[model samples]
Target: MWVADYLSLLITCQAMSQSDMEGVEQCFLDISVDQVLHYDGVPAVEPWATMYIDAIHDKRFGDAIWARYQIFGDVVDGLIDDGRLTVLESIEEDAVGYKKNAPEAFDEAVAFYKSVTNSADGHPEVIEIIMRIDKEDVSNRYFPEGG
Candidate 1:
């Protein structure tokens, strides 16, 4: 799945040693800007984006995170360009620390979810994706291990 693909990239990014600048650059190259920009995966995969952003802020990834951040921006811009407006808006809103306003954020997410599900653009595959994501055990859902 796309989430697994993303997580694999992130895990590879995080595991790179400081001396592996060449490998780091290659990793950056491997993460296609087009793919990130066109990402149409379910909302459950959103945390992987956060994980990438968090890696940027972390000291462990060193300066490679800056390049990752640039790619992330490209992805965001792509989302905007592709008319994934709600996804972009949700990302912006979620950045405000959802834990501090869990109830409100969750309600908003649910409302947003309903809107998406009910939209004319909605499809059976999208609903299936949502149902698959929703059915995962909470532990695996939230803290999935990279394979």
Candidate 2:
């Protein structure tokens, strides 16, 4: 499933018309993966709060990183309620801090998520995973182990 998603993300980007791919921010599209979660069969599935946090490790997307973290918090909150995945105690602290510092960035993050997930078919799920993993890389910068 993960491989399918990964390939889908790559193929989707490749299939995207030049203008469509160009519309995507080069920074958001940075091709990096969190090595911690990239191992085979990690069961690294949903409520992907950690992945979202990890993505912001890059300073180039400073505010955007914070924004994606915030958005992940919101999604995780809902997922927790829905019995999807347990929220990690460590990230809960950062999520609180992010909410206080960058409320608007969080909003933008949610919009970013919706925009990416609510798209064309084919490799849609792959795109979602890519976004989740990329967002996590950004958030990892705040975590001790992530650095």
Candidate 3:
């Protein structure tokens, strides 16, 4: 799912209360650190914007798997746009890092992400966004792995 789609869960929350924050913690599941960086300046959908800003600023979330998972989601989205993955989804806690089948694009995404994460000038990890048209299952697999 795209960041905008993932943020839908946050919009459903009534307010930025503790429970609300707790409820939408997983909403951060499928977005990128790069995307979250822009939320501060861009007008967002209510409590989601407030929540994301706070979440990204948290050192623990920013440095750990939470952020990685979020960015992975973006990477997967990017890969899909690039034609690497056929499909991706969040299938509970058991299946970490959603994937349909193995694809080389996953490696590329991970490599870049890890490279930037471990690099000195990486904090503001930025990723390219590709706009893709939805296609059927039959021919989708033949697509390339980048925009």
Candidate 4:
């Protein structure tokens, strides 16, 4: 699963008052730190905006994931254009500072998340938002950890 997707799961569980955060955290996920260390004001996820707005119009309780979407939904949508999707292969070369040095930590985090989701059979649909966000390496700092 992607970083934003993982975060959304945590936020969703937190908002729902579910204990999934423990499962997520105990899995040793690390996208949160990678997001903090790599932000550069790029855009974010588009599908999450659509899903969040749709949820807002519905009668559901305030999902922590949705609340996070509320915070960054616009930015997420802006990342996409009418006819294309941005694809981030990985962190850029000459990453300048912290991003240059954080690969091992980030990879460790990603591995844990993979293990957790694999153990679960598969990641849930809610995590797709984070996947979308992470795929672009867009600015995902708005969705905080432990939210």
lDDT of candidate 3 over 1-147, digit per residue (tens): 788866865754432344323222232233433344445333344344444445544422323332333332444433333443432322111122212232244344334343433322222322211001111122333333342
lDDT of 4 at 63: 29
lDDT of 4: 0.32
Which 10 consecutive residues of model 3 have the lowest summed lDDT? 127-136
lDDT of 3 at 57: 41
Pairs in steric clash, model 1: none
RMSD of each: 17.9, 13.0, 15.5, 14.3
Better of 1 and 4 by lDDT: 1
How does residue 33 of candidate 4 score in lDDT?
20
Write the number of the candidate with greater lDDT, choosing between 2 and 3: 2
Consecutive 10-residue window with the lowest summed lDDT within model 4:
87-96
- Per-candidate clashes come to 0, 18, 1, 2
State the lDDT at 35 in candidate 4. 29
Superposed Cα deviation of residue 46, candidate 2 (Å): 16
lDDT of 2 at 127: 36
Q: lDDT tens string, model 4, 1-147?
A: 699999986765455423311212211121122221223242334454344333322422122233332333443343322213211111121111112245454344344434434223222433333334334453433322222
Task: TM-score for candidate 3, please give it.
Answer: 0.23
The candidate with the higher TM-score, 1 or 4, is 4
- Per-residue error for 44 in candidate 3, Å, reads 3.8
